[model samples]
Target: MEIYQLVFETAIEINPGAVAVGAALGIVVGVPLGAAIAKLVQKRAERGVKGTARVGRLRAKRAWDA
Candidate 1:
C-alpha cells in the first residue's frame, strides 16, 4: 500500500538511525490504531444488525395484533 511505503520512505529521508526507529514506531502505532478502527467498525455493524432485527420484531408484533 502507498501508506505503508510512505512510512519507510519518510524514515529513509530522515537519517539512517531513524529508519529503523521509525519503522518500529510505525508498526507499534499502526497495530493499535488498526485494531481500534476494526473494533469501531465491528460495533457499528452489530448495532445495525440489532436495530434491523428490532424493527422486524416490531413489525411482526403489529401484524400479529391486527
Candidate 2:
C-alpha cells in the first residue's frame, strides 16, 4: 500500500479520540501562529518603508541646501 493509505489506516486504528483532539489543537495553534507570522512581516515592512522615507528626506534636504 502507498504511504498515505497506510498512514490513514494507522491513524484511524489508533485512538480516534486522540486524533480528533490533536486535530482540534492543531487548528487552534495554527490560526494564531499564522496570524503572528503575518503581523511580524507587516511590521517589518512598515519599519523598512519608514526608514527609507527618512533617508530620502534627508538626502533631499542636503541636495537643496547645496
lDDT of 2 by residue, 1-66 (tens): 699778867897987888788789999999999999999879978777657678789999999999
Q: After superposition, how far is residue 24 of candidate 1 from its true place, in Å?
A: 0.4
At residue 60, what lDDT does model 1 achieve?
Answer: 100
| Candidates in order: C-alpha RMSD to true structure | 13.2, 14.9
Model 1 over residues 5-65: C-alpha lDDT tens digits? 8976876877868788867898999999999999987998877765767877999999999
Q: Which ten residues in a row have the lowest lDDT in candidate 1?
A: 46-55
Q: Where does candidate 1 clash, by residue pair?
A: none
Clashing pairs in 2: none
Error of 1 at 54 (Å): 23
lDDT of 1 at 8: 67
| Model 2: lowest-lDDT 10 consecutive positions | 46-55
